[model samples]
Target: MDDFYSKQSPFNPDVKSFRFYKNGNLKIELKTKEDAEKVARLLLP
Candidate 1:
């Protein structure tokens, strides 16, 4: 399963900085820890 495909919650970006909240528009339930890491990597990449 090396070819993994992951997607982001659409409202993830609109989230306030330094504040954590669940995105209301995604089709999947993205955990806070997972979302934070994903968003961090996306921005830093």
Candidate 2:
């Protein structure tokens, strides 16, 4: 298998950029280019 272990620097947070969500039951929107997909997959949903 290809080694796909990610590096810390490769997933650095965007200080000026961030995802936003109102409440737990509300809608959530993420920065388009911030690799939000990876983060989203980590959610319980």
Whole-model lDDT per candidate: 0.48, 0.40
Q: How high is each candidate's TM-score? A: 0.31, 0.28
Judged by TM-score, which candidate is best? 1
Badly placed stretches (over 4 Å) of model 2 are 1-24
lDDT of 2 by residue, 1-45 (tens): 323332122234432233323332332334464546766678848
TM-score of candidate 1 relative to the true fold? 0.31
lDDT of 2: 0.40
Model 2 lDDT at residue 5: 32
- Worst ten-residue run, lDDT, model 1? 17-26
21-41 per-residue lDDT for model 1 (tens digits): 344333334457767677679
Backbone clashes in candidate 1 total 0
Q: lDDT score of model 1?
A: 0.48
Best by lDDT: 1
